[model samples]
Target: MYNVDDVVMYGTFGICKITAVEKRNFTGEEQEYFVLRHVNSDKNVFYVPTDNEAALSKLHSVCSKSDVDALISHMNSEKLIWIDNDAKRKEEYSRIIKEADYHEIIMLIKTLYLRRKELGAAGKKLRSSDENYLNLAENMLFEEFAYALDIERREVVDYIEKHIA
Candidate 1:
């Protein structure tokens, strides 16, 4: 039950604002929908059904600076046990992205970062699949943090680095 102007992280779209909530009789049925506009985009609007729990669950409240600080504090100790099997790892990555849990996303980023470093040290490159998820996770995290912290998206990496123990 979000009100107008309330900011929330809407799945991969990152932070968005609830601009309106109304019942519309589309498809010959009246149902409530939350009209959302992306905080960073001027023209993107999303109409999400109010009662769709799966979709609704994707809408998470933007984390505060304190929350980000807490996440950073735990970053070093968070264990990201890598799944060596390609198929299994992909499936796990998909679940993490879909779930979009802040801590899990951080773990994904940290895991991939460490993996990339290890590969580089061994004269190898990160696998394409890993690279793709790494970028996605970073994008999701940076967008939300930037919006909540009132900073540019490019600053998130350095910001988190400063906070990480």
Candidate 2:
């Protein structure tokens, strides 16, 4: 139930501004769609069905700076769980990324970051799958954080470090 010009977090697409809510008979039946324009990319646009609750469930309002701070603070006390099985770990990572929950995404990023550091200290490297999910989680979380906190994308890591250090 977002209105025009409302900014929302649309799953992995990151921050999107609702440009319009229009009814069109694209499938031979009149249906409403929320036209979203990606805030980070001018050429990217998305049309989400207005009545689809499952899809709409993924649309979350942009969090406030206080919310971001709270989430980061919470992360300091959260425990990291690492799955040893690659297949299961990948599936779990995919689910967390797809769900795009702020806390869960932070967990994924924190877990992978620690894992990467551990592997590096042992003279090893992250498995390709782990690396990919880490990057995806970081990108998604940072994008939302940047838009919400009014900071540049590149500054997210440093911001998090300063806040959580």
Candidate 2 local lDDT, 1-165, one digit each (tens): 789999999888889999999997878999999999999788998889999999898898999899999998888877786899988999999999888888888888889999999999999999999999999988888998998789999998899889998
For residue 41, what is the lDDT in candidate 2?
Answer: 88
Clashes of each: 0, 0
Task: Give Cα-based local distance difference scores for all models.
Answer: 0.88, 0.90
* Tens-digit lDDT string for candidate 1 (1-165): 778889999988878999989998777999999999998787988888899999898898899988877877888889885889999999999899999988888889989999999999999999999999999999999898887678999998888788873
Off by over 4 Å in 1: 25-28
Q: Against the true structure, whose TM-score is highest?
A: 2
Cα RMSD, model 1: 1.4
How well does candidate 2 score on lDDT at residue 161? 85
